[model samples]
Target chain A: MAVQEAKRANRLKSGKLVNKLVNEYWEDLINAKKTGKKVVYTTGLPIGPFMAAQDMAWIHGEGYGARVAARHEEKEPQTFAENKGFNRELCSYARTQMGCAMFAELGVPDDLNPGPIATEIPAPDAIVTCYPGCSTGPQWDWAIERVFGKKIPWFNVVIPYHMGRNGSTYMKGEEFEENVKYVVRQFEDLIKFLEVVSGKPYNWDKFQELMGVTKKVGKLRMEAMELCKAKPAPASFFDWSIQIAPVNYLTAWPGTVEAMQAVKDEVQERLDNGVSAVPNEKYRIFWEGIMNWNKLGWMADKFASYDATVVAGRYTHMAFWHEPDTIDPEHPLRGIAINHLECQLNLGYPITEERMMTLSKDYSIDGIVFHGARTCRSFSRSHFLLAENLNKKMGIQSTSFEGDMVDDSFYKEELVNTRIEALIESLEAQKSRG
Target chain B: MTSKSDRSSFYTMGVDSGSLTGKAVIIDGNRQIVSHSVKQLGFVSQKAVMMAIDDALEKAGLALEDITYTVSTGYGRKRLEIAGKNLTEISCHAKGANYLYPEVKTVIDIGGQDSKVIAVDPSGNVKNFAMNDKCAAGTGQFLEVLARALDVELTEIGALSLQSDADIKISSMCTTFAESEVISLVAEGHTTVDILSGMHKAISGRMKGLVGRVGMQQPVMMTGGGAKNIGLVKALEKTLGVSIFIPDEPQIIGALGAALFANDFATGIRKKVEEEQDLDKSRVPAKDCASCSVQNFQLNKN
Candidate 1:
């Protein structure tokens, strides 16, 4: 009953509100003097399963007071004096992350107000990182040392490339078991360290309960996958993706089972009614790059007249299935670790190709669409090859469109529409041959 | 000409002495050894060539005398005094990617000064390649400059980007504008972590634009030092929506491929010599130098 109340309370917290609170919690930690609490800092990508896993791990394990610093999302305001001396031809990720670090180091208050930055989170006591899968992860660690004038102890969990695939490679019974075993071992060690630091007993029962929730959530996810396969496809890939967030964030929490149950029951009921999540299937194209500021409807409406449904996409299913099923309760952190390693962004190109092919084949996709986002190279690097190969290999027509995830200027409707039209025609011709 | 019997077991070397680095590959008839030694290019290219050759021989556990033939490549190829032949970097990279992964059809190499997108056949032959050597946008130099501006080491960029929480906007595409933007952000009190994330996104975005032009193929391997950057790899994956393969040692792919070519070229030469010997009895002595009838004959046949 208490859990239900907690879930209800959580439900009332909108994403924006939660983000604000998280921001405030960080601010409090940054301002507060050392309370002898051990704070471990970890980095994350913005959109992948690993990010959710890290969030859950921190929230559940250390609470909101934990000094969690994302590599860089903060923008430092530029003064006219400094602007004159800055170079114009630098990579943007470096600029942003470095800017944020400088901002934090100066102890400058938020430029918006005359007070300290909202999130004055203190320097991390220790750093946990995944290796060089992304440029920002390593760079941020360097920035921390440069700005803070100290080197934090760093530990890493290596994610192999084999975990990104779907079939025998990733879901192999023994391999999955071994993966779980490895993660559990790591978690046990982490717990021991935490126990020593906190001067408290590790909550074995809490961990077990969390594992149970994870198993339930995993089962519910399978059901959701089935729902995705439902005749006519139950909902928009965008909607389905959003609905799965709770399952991702709360996987190891007590609320997860109920959240998964609620989501599953809701989806199942919709499936039974033969109702579609998004009634209009305009131009069903695969979306690339995190959906433009969650403005999926913008893209959906663009192809609405053409009956596009966005049958499959990297931002949706590609990111979702990247995580393995969490069945074992003994080592909960292992499941989180797997989720971290299995993120689409973390796996290098070979595994990405395999996953793209799998999603295309499984979803009966019509065409491959790539977003030539201006801000990201990791996701943009080999899209052209992927598109060309998919066309030749799978007979699925493909096209690359230009757009930024945040900046609207990069998204040109006319240019994108023309390309989309050509792609659709090509896909239609291929479909006719079948 | 080297006799077929004597050259059958002779080792050959291919030195791809590039602007940013030097590579030497030694082929011992049946096996190949690739040794890559990276150093700054000096006024004279011979020093670079010698260094690369020595490195290759050391790696192969063979002496310099064991190498019977040498092929050189890259911009400095012509300057290598010991080279028997010079090849282009494009051919060498294609050959390298094909040698490492026989199934690879496309090679995306992000080198220090330039980025190249190559399309090749399964047999390691280059079909077509588009290069962005003129610009720094999609090359490793772009990242290096960004690293300096951010005050972070180049090696740590990839691991650091994994920490990004927000998608900080990088308004500039030009390297100069981008650097200033980073500095301004620093003055404004933004975290260095966010700026670096933005820089990676920008570079990935530029590379995506380049990759979009050639079209991608499966089993695509990333070559060059930039491949070492984990953050860029992830950014590329996010942008392309496909996974990229990084071999055990990504930086050595070009050298390895060049070495494989040495083996193939030596074998081809031996075969050619044998074929010539067999045709010696039927050889014609005289031919017109200025006006050859072969062109007319070929045209007539077509």
Candidate 2:
């Protein structure tokens, strides 16, 4: 048969709202210095509630890196950092973060900076980082600290290693309790630091209330993703990836509750109307690892051409949904500590493998796509082992491609296309055999 | 291979439009390859694809209209407007290699610009595969470049490599760097055989890593242009610790696989037609000849 025309994935109405909020957030970030609002730089931890409680404007470094990549403007910042003696092998997101800081410090022209936005990032009064088993996250923060000559207050939250041998066990007994206490102590210290920076007393009630909002958003997000368990998924992982800004960057904001509700409602309406994200969906796939920001649209179309829909991705579902109900608003800091400790990245591969198996069965996934981002070793590990176990243990097929999350140059269109098509062909052959 | 009882006059064609060349294979209903042609691709002219097709048709003494179906494969498979369907090279290679050697559990294909190792199941489905991306480190183009740098014919490098006794190592992992390394080896007075041996070893080492991704199985078959290089095949066999198998014309295996798929398509259509005819016979009354004729007419019209 002739190859069908590639169609873009259907966008949700809520996605437009997310785009607006994200733009507004960017404007607020840019104007933070002038408005005397406290701005903070943070990593990809679920600390948005804390920042929101403090009424602070925050720039999520990883999120900003994704925006720069999606805009197809990562090359300049990446090269700029490389010229400053940063190894090209470092994480592209880290490189971009460092490059932007260097550019701002060096008084580089706005046009030369080539960020997702034209404006320079407002200098943060404090930076909150974490050690969640991802070295790149903390290393980038330290590098940026050195770049700015220690002018900013840096607070690092040490999230202990929670996974046991073979990734099969979580820390148990006294060790688990001690780990939570350790992180909670750090959170208390961080609160003190934030209070000093904001020049106000810490509000326990406000923090508790924001934590409640975060829990609601996480539960709603998980419910919407659960709706994808339908045969013809209403929203693909690609659509979900696009709408993550609110949950990741604006979690405690009241607008996020509405944003996530709209997302859930839109998905429900599609299910009611018998709409499919991929028309005549032939296959359901689970994507593993970070999104290739540069190829999001292109990859969506490629999968759609084969009538395959990527229904679930562990990374895209990374809202506050890592055991959302476990977080109690009454004791917010300890719950946040548990939430941080339970992150998928901090959990070992055996745990990831188990989750993938569950995802395959739950989503009726016919295959898995393992995207090994060149720089993100955190997610790149054990892909081969996972693919083997999934195939041997569960009889699910899989395929893999190597590319960077942000660096477009690392992605080869023809190579990735061939691998995807080959996967579809193999799936079809297996179906015929049955 | 198909039995003689399965033989028929119906013909199908498979075209493989690759990076450096285009190939076409024609097969009969018996799944027997009748004729094939290969043509080199040129920058401004993709006529190689059509030319290969015409040549194969001419040799088979058939016209384009006589062919029941056409399936195209390889890098340029989609660009073939006349193909009934296009498939990835991974599937095609596995199908073709399995057809050649029914026991083949894996296929290692080294093309001009890229190389792939495909794991095949017992039923001839692609189990898994891995390929080198955006690199010419272990491909036909890499060998072609080094052969020119050594002032030797492409056809002679393989046999020459076999004659070498001293073990030389080509340390560079890139094709361009390897060429410069080869030139420097010549300046250092290394024999042509030794340098060729080093190049073969380097290419085989790279192929080993690609094969490792899919977990190589026994009864391995090697295809594509690189399969023509005897030294590379020997080196691969040694590196992978398994005996390798090669087809009579390894480069056309993808086209042959496409031809097999075309035959399957034509067979499906023939079966459906026969089934409809049987249904029509069953629906009509035996005594009512005139009514039967009318029903048959309506069925054909629909």
Candidate 3:
């Protein structure tokens, strides 16, 4: 868990504020154990606001897995899970968090330390498993409880897939309302479950206030991401990936709203001053999959070296921005269910493809980099088709490479390097012709 | 030959250090090839690359210092200390094939340990490309492994495949699985020619997938060491439904392309120097970095 600062130039100074915010968030998690605050581990959903409302500490499994990968410490834990007969094909993030639980049982091996960021992953008082997008993530929650071998209280919610109803852009009409009602009923059960765990009555009024704050945070984050639409993008997709921690993990934290505002102001100032994230940016790229957490910095510098900037990624831009303006404070749970069901990952391919096309035009993308995550089939599947559709529909050339989100062994640096170089060569040729 | 004393005479060099071979080409100011050489690579690819350059230098009656610029290409291009710049073999292969066969729209390069399909424009610019993953299923290395397994000499397998009397098919494109299948076929009293032909067909099948990724275009050219295999060429022709084009020396195409890039880079440098010499030296001018080869050098380090 040794965090190395990236050596790239023109990094946003405001990124430090978010990093500080994340560090404090982790500190709060550690202090939760000592303060007798009920700690809950959950899959990514809109449940963080509710947890905050209930005065509980939330640890998102996927967020911690990304942190593990960013520190280049996924190997020992991933291997630990694989050695115990878990298939390597399972989601790397799931395996990584699972391995952390195993380490809790049989202490971390010698020559390895959990380090500052990974230290003291408190046992969950309750588990809320929400399958917003990922099919493999629901199993992760059940597996974690078994790993601990504890009689832990847990609730699971599965949202129906987001295909457009009545020919709308996404889910709509009575069908969408029914889906929301189903998830709302599940959320009510979850609220009851949380009330028993914390020994307190559910506060709908406080929850409504937190949901409003969450909407503000999402709006600020989305506006900051949209600033990259400038000709000389003030931030690269890699920058957004690093800065995504607050929105992804700390959305309900106290300073998260202020932290997001600071980021938005900084990006706006850069856009005004014409300060590009990658100097001498020539080609703008739209990244089309999960960030290779282990190679985040390396890949950023690689693209920058070719005078190409990865301006935006759907994962970073859409993770927090689930139509912030549409969240109804009066009916917060229904709003949450609708957003979760209609999130980018849960949407049908045609809808996703349409979104990417619109973004490609809005961002003036020259090409796309489709990273096929080795362990995450949900994101990796149909990438070739998507790239082809973009090329045919928008005349945008693309390159595809195989990699894993958390597993470093699944990536071949040289292979990806060659692919990117070839892409730049094509871009250069096109520019020259014009 | 142009004398070394002539300042206007520019000689550019290119070295391509591949997985199994090293190639070098020297071109004169008029962009005509002066001399070219290829050497079998050893454990030290850098040394083999240097040897290839030395052989080309000796043939051209020139010294290394006489060359104005050098650009390296291929997998081991980065390891060459002498290269002023390095480019990926994908771009170099496309450029080389386009230069060799201007009508070629697609270039399928099967090298030592990998295969790639590149789509090129009429102007020798790469439009798109596709490469095999981290597997050696359809490459010279795979052929060598199977050659060793069949107890047949590598050079003779292509001709032996051409003489096959029975049509055969190898189901697996995985190198290890195909080798096992070859062993099983040998035990079943299958002829070596038929087995080699089947292996060639299997390789062609894998190549078809790569070609399909970047949609195939007519007037295709084949390059690299694998292109020397007549059996693979014929099998690929049948699989792709097109007549293939082959250079006289396919393995050195990447080196030729690197040499061409060196010539272009040298021309740009010369033009910049003349422009700078004509301007006011006292005034600091805005640097035009877009066309500079040094930018490519910086990119290579990353």
Candidate 4:
């Protein structure tokens, strides 16, 4: 018998643009820190445009995670953090960041040589952050306060939930308007912290201009996601995982928009020619919950084995969808506030399930693969309920397996393969019955 | 271990090669258990699987070819080349549990490395399931480690655990951590029975949380090698506040389910072939009448 090589994902023009843009920003972050230019390592913040206006460098926490995870370089940092008080139960990205911090103390692992995302990740002069209804808040707080063995100026931007107070768990109806006002106030305060850290007064024009760019990116994201509705999507969500760099870190950059446009065009080309991301795409699957980042390539190949493609996912498109009308540059901070407010993580469990159902219908998804990520309590907690509801209401087939965002030890590949293969069988059976 | 054969007429086999044990069940066309074997799994799961298969085959007075269809399941199911097909232990366990107790809507399988709770639909298909695979703290492997720590035989620990009169607790929630805790408890002069009782309760507490994840729909059937531990069963019963049912041969449930699947798969293939033959009979001359007749006879018997 002859040997057969695994088929590799085509490197699209958009993918190259995204990598170049992300790598350049990361290199600039390192250079900015070395040259005495203030660089901010942050979680989800509404200040990218503000930082871009000055010499300040901004690195998104999730963007850092994607880079390290891409190279299969998260293990050492993850272990370093786990050895410390930070449990594996914290978000995988958070732990990796913590582990990356210990490179000086725990010493850098030979493999890391401290790569673009991790080893070279400078200690944040300040970490601009907010909860946005996920585990990122506490993890970000830890990233600033304790990860470096000393506290730094950390902006804990409090975004109101349902009732526009600190406590409401669900996103409510009328409070959404007031909730935006409250979150904008927090963003305004976050700008104050940014001013103090950068020693320069905040600029409204820069902020508004960045918001306009962000709105464009958001619009493009919303539009590109609609393409998955095609029978065989032009790209899988795993491919979209690469887009997180441009989406999360370089949000308002023109190159990011250009990159996204290139993606949209390529996908259109694929649809025109009746091409698919997964060859002979027999099953269209919608993935829910956080990613199995370390095993992403393996998971994608596994889907290919069954001729299944993860056409859409909650993560790649984000949990919430908004249009141009939703993002107003005049009230930029307010619009950014509302964006986080409507984020999938902030919404209550019931709303998330409803969104999952909508996506299932929109994508014509035959199955759902919920990654029962160990660290992400909020998302992992609702999988069973979400799956049960989707099964009961939509008659959709769903399956879940335990995984960690970047930790390899948390999941067994064979176990995941069997569960997915089993799900495929169940989906086939369901279709046959219909 | 190979059990004495109750009968010698068996034509179908089910092999469950798990993380730690390889179990095989041989059933006749009537689905009666003719022979079964349970062997400790080794590094080479294939060898262990073959060992179990050959034992069952020997006890049933049969050769490998004599078995019509072999369905392999469990963790090592895919590794076995001898099996005609394979199914996940979740589906197989549900099917196996349903065969033993048809009303069973839940299956709590505490296997060597992981503990799983599955909700079974009326047709024996799994509705939803939760697993505690990442941690060995609440599984058979946990008990094995604790048994070694206590210097007690695993089989005896269960019976001895029931004899314990003292109330004891295992503080650590991790298997390795609990081993150290067990050492300290022993240094403090806890009896083997008391420590074993605590171990069972610790496992029960963990299993209880896992069962809650899937939600309980009883009557719950407990299978796998862990089901053989009476003390763990009692502990689970107490924690869950419900009576749990165990099959006569709990360890072979997975293999039994695979056997049932094999029987069904073989039967389905035969029916399809016969239907094709019937279609051929009308459109063209039958080229292979002898083979068709043999398959036709097989279909009729099924």
Name the regions of candidate 1 deviating beyond 4 angstroms: A1-39, A45-123, A163-168, A172-189, A192-201, A240-256, A294-297, A303-306, A318-326, A333-341, A346-351, A404-418, A428-434, B1-302
Clashing pairs in 3: none
Q: Fnat of each prediction?
A: 0.05, 0.40, 0.38, 0.10
Give the per-residue lDDT of model 1 (tens digit) for B35-113: 4555445532567667767876887678877776677666566577676655556667777788778898778888765
Q: Which stretches of candidate 3 lie over 4 Å from their true place?
A: A1-7, A44-46, A111-116, A164-168, A171-182, B1-9, B42-44, B133-137, B145-152, B161-198, B274-302
Which model, 3 or 4, shows the larger DockQ?
3
> Tens-digit lDDT track for model 2 on A287-389?
9888988888888877887889999987875334556787799988877887777666776666667777877888999998888888888877878788778
TM-score of each: 0.48, 0.88, 0.89, 0.84
A-chain TM-score in candidate 2?
0.94
Tens-place lDDT digits, model 4, residues B1-302: 11234222336789998888899998876677778998885632777788899899899888888887889888787777778888878778888898888899999999887688888777776766667636566888889999999999888888999998788999786889999999999999999899999989988888887787667988999998899999999999999999999899888898998888887776667668778777665554445686564443322322
Task: List, residue by residue over A312-382, the lDDT tens digit for candidate 4.
Answer: 88776543325345778877766676667777666666666767787889999988888887877766777
What's the alpha carbon RMSD for model 4? 6.3
| TM-score of the first chain in candidate 3 relative to the native first chain | 0.94
Q: What are the Cα lDDT values of the candidates?
A: 0.57, 0.82, 0.82, 0.75
TM-score of chain A of 4: 0.90
Docking class of predicted structure 2:
acceptable
